[model samples]
Target: METPIKIDISVIVPSYNGMPLFKTSLDSVLAQEGVIYEVLVGNDSPSDGETKNYLNQIENKDLRVFHNEKNLGLFGNLNNLIKHAKGDIVHLWSQDDIMNPNCLLETVKFHNSHPNIAYAFSRVEVINEHDEVIDKTPLSNNDTMSALTHTLTSLMAGSVPGNIANVSIRKNIFETYGYFDVNLKYSGDFEFWCRITEHLPVGIIQKYLIKLRRHTGQLSRNPKMWIYRIEENDAILETLLNRVPKNKLKYINRGLKWRVYNQYFGLYLNLLRSGDNKEAQAFLRVIKKYSNISGFYFRYVILKILSVIKRDKKFLHWLYYKQAFGNNGK
Candidate 1:
C-alpha cells in the first residue's frame, strides 16, 4: 500500500473578486515543488460563477475548495480559512499575488530549521497588472532577531518583512496570539505584524519568493479607505510606542513620524486631487497630531508647499518612492 504524503504546510488563499489573476496565482501555488503541502482556497465570492467554475475545473488532488455563501471581505475570509486549515504552518496568501516555485519549499525549510519562530516572511518582486516586474523590495538580513529589534524595524520601514503573500505563520500561534483583526481594512497586516513581533521573534527568508501584483483595483490604492487607514495606523503606532523603553522611545517616535510622512503623504495628495476633501482633512489632522515630534512640522510644511507646485509634484513623488522602496524610484 502507498502512504499518503504528510502535509506539513497549508497554503490558504482567501479569494474574492480574484479572477484572471487568481488563475495565475493558483497556478503558481500549484506549481510549488519539493514540499508535501495542501492548497486550501476559501472562495469568498460564492456567487461569482467564473471563480467557482474555474476552481471546479482544476484537477489537482492536493487542492481543496470551499464556498462562503456570502462575501466576508479579506481578513474575514482569511480568519475563516485559518479555522479550516490542517497544516501546522499556514501561509495566508493574497489572491492576486504569484509565488515563486520554491516559495513553499524555502518557507518549510526555514520553519523546520527554526522551530521557535512563530512568524516569518520573504522579499517580493513588485509586478504590475500585466505580470511585468516593476521593482523589488529591499533585502532583509534579519534571519533572526529579538522582539524589540523586530518592532523597531517595523516602525522604521513599515512592515519590514514585505507582502502578506510571503508571510508564513505557525497555525498553532494563531490560537495563542489571536487571528488577523478584521476591523482594520487597510493596515491589518501591518498591525498583525506589530502585534505578533511584540511577543515572538520573526525571521526573514532572504529571497524574493513572491510576486506582489499592484493594480488600480486593489483596496490599498483606494482613496475612499484613507480615513480607516490613518485611524488604524494611529492605533498601531500608539500600541507599539507603549511597548518601547523610554530611552529608545524617542528614536522610534522619530521613525514613526517619518514613516507616516513618507507612506501616506502621497495618498493624502491623491485624496485632495480626487476631491475627497473630508478624507484629506482627516489625514491632515493625523499629521497635525504627530506634528509635536520635533522635526515633523517642518516636513509637513515642506511637502505641503512642494505639493502645490506643478513641477515639484514629481520630486515629491520620487521622494516618497525612494524612501518607501529604497531603490531610488526604480
Candidate 2:
C-alpha cells in the first residue's frame, strides 16, 4: 500500500488568469520553511492560452494543480479547494499576494502553543504593483483585548485586523461552522471571520507575515463593487446584532453606526469624484436609510459642497482626513 501523506498545512491558491502575479505568489509559497505543507492551485477554468500553458509547466512534487470544469468565482473556487485539501490546517492564499518566508513557521508555532485557538492570523505588509512596501496593518498587540472584543470592534469600525492571506484555520472549523458563504461577493471573508470568532478564540501573531498587493485589478478598487459591499455589510451587521449578548448591545449599536457612516460616506465620495451623480445620490439614500442622526447628514452635505467647490481630489482627501481623524491626525 502507498504511504499516506502527513501534511501540516495546505496553502490553497485560487487563480483566474492571475499569471505574472500568480508566479510570484507560487514562488513565495514554495520558499516557505519549517513546515510540512502542500501547495494547491485551483485554476477557475482559465480561458487564456498563456495561463493554461503556465499551469501545464508546473512540475513540483509538493504542488498539485486542479482545473474547474467551469468558471467558479472567488468564493466558489475556495470551496472547491477546501474539499481537496488533505492537510490538518488550511491557509487561503491570494493569487496576487506574496507570503513571508516565516509565515507558515510562525503560524504553526502559534497554533501549537495555543491548542485552543482554531483561527490564527498575523499582521500584514501592504505592497503596490511594483512590489514596493506601502503600509503595514495596525493590528492591536494589546494582549488584554479579548477575542470577542477585538473581532467585534474591528468589524464594527469598517476594518479588518488581518487579511485573508495571513490567516490559517483548522480544517475542522469548517465542518463545525460551515464553509464560506459562496453567495457573498465582497463580505464573505469578513462574515466568516465574524462567525468563527464567535465560536473559537482567535490567535494573533504580531509579525508581518504576508504581503497584500494593492492594484487596479483588485475587486475592492472597483467603484461598482462598493455597492454590493455596502448591501452585504448591512446584512452581516444585522446578523451580528441578533447574536450579540444583551449586555454588549450598546457597543454593537455604536459600532454599527460607525461602520455604516464610514462605508456610505466613503462610497459617496468615490461616486461623486467619478462623476456618477446617480450612484452618489443612491449612496446618500443608503446613508439616510441606516441612520437619521443629524450629524451624519450634516457631514454628508458639507462634504458634497466642499467637493463641488474645490474639485481637487487631493484637497477633498485632506478634508476627509481632517473630519474623520481630526486635525492632529490621531
Candidate 3:
C-alpha cells in the first residue's frame, strides 16, 4: 500500500515573471530543513514564460507548481494559491523574498506549541536588490502583542508583519475570516492582516525568518500605486476604529488622525514641489477624507506657499520636519 504524505505547511509563492529573483526565493524554500512542508508556486500567467521554463528544469519531490489561466492581480493570485494549498498551515511567501533555512521549522514548532493563535509573523531582515541587509522588523518583549496594540500599530504607525514572507497562517483562519480583498491593489495584505487581528491574537517570533527584498519595481514604491493605497486605507481604518472599545476610542482615534495627517500631508507637499499637481490634489483629498485634526489646512497652506515661493531647500526641509514630526520629531 502507498503511504499518504503528511504535509504540515504549504509555503505558497505567487509569481509573475520575476525570473532569477524567483529562483533565489524558491531555492531558499527548498533548502528549509526539519519540516514536512511543500512549496507551491502559483505562476500568475507571466508573459515571459521564464518562470514556467525554470520550474520545468527543477525536480524536487517537495515542490508543486500551478499556473493561472490569466493574471489575477496580487491578492487574487494569493487567494487562488490558498485554494490549492494542502497543508494545515499556509505560509504566503513573496516571489522575491529569501527565507532563512529554519523559517518553516520554527513556524511549525511555534504553531504546534501555541495551538490557539490564528497567525504568527517573525522578524525579517530588509534587504536591497543586491541582497544586502538594510534593516529589520522590531522585536517584541512578548510572544504576542494584544490585538488592540497590533491593530493600532498597523493602522497608526506602519504595518506589523510587514510583508508576506514574515507571516504564516493556519489554513482554517482563511476559511473563517475570508480571503484577501481583490480590489485592493497595493494594500490588500495590510487590510487582511488587520481583519484577522480583530478576532485573534497574532503571535510574533523574535528570530529573523526571511530577507524581504526591496526594489524600485515593487508596486509599493511606485508613485502611481499610492492612490490605490490611500483608497484602501479609508476602509481599513473604518473597520478597525469601529472595533475599538469605547475606553480606548478617544486616544486611538487621535493617534490615527495624526498619522493620516502626517503621512498624506507630507506626500502632498512633495508632489506639489515636484509639480505633480494632480497627484498632490489627490493626496490632499485623502488627508481631508481621513483626518479632521486641527492645523492640517493651516500647515497645508504654509507648505503650499513655501513650495510656490521656491524657498530655501534647507528651511523647507526643516519646516516639514517641524510640521510632520512636531515635539522632538515624535
lDDT string for model 3 (1-330, tens) is: 989988999998988888889988999999999989998888887575778889888999998887777889878988988888899999989889999999999999988887778589998899998999999877767787667667656666556776777889999999999999998888888888898888678888888888999999987776656766777677787887787667657656655544445557777767889899987887677667655535776655655676688863444335333333334233
Q: Cα miss at 194, model 1 (Å)?
A: 1.8
Q: What TM-scores do the predictions have? A: 0.84, 0.84, 0.86
Per-residue lDDT, model 2, residue 185, is 80
Q: List model 1 lDDT by residue over 74-176, tens digit each.
A: 8888888888888889997989899999999899999999888759888889999888999987875558767876766666666766567889999888898
lDDT to native, each model: 0.78, 0.75, 0.79
Model 2 C-alpha lDDT per residue in residues 1-330, reported as the tens digit of each score: 999879988998889888899888989999999999998888886576676788789788889888777888888888888888999889889889999999988877777777776577788899999999999877675422345554555545543554678878888888888988988988888888787776566777878889999998887778777777878888777766666667656645544454447556777778889999998887777666776647676656665666688753444334432333233223
Once model 3 is optimally superposed onto the true structure by TM-score, how far is the C-alpha of residue 308 displaced, in angstroms?
23
RMSD to true structure for each model, in Å:
5.4, 5.7, 5.7
| Candidate 3 backbone collisions, by pair | none
RMSD of 2: 5.7
Off by over 4 Å in 2: 139-147, 292-295, 299-330
Cα shift from native, residue 140, model 2 (Å): 5.1
Question: Which regions in candidate 3 have their CA more than 4 angstroms from the true location?
Answer: 291-294, 297-330
- The TM-score of predicted model 1 comes to 0.84
In model 1, where is the ten-residue run with the lowest total lDDT? 320-329
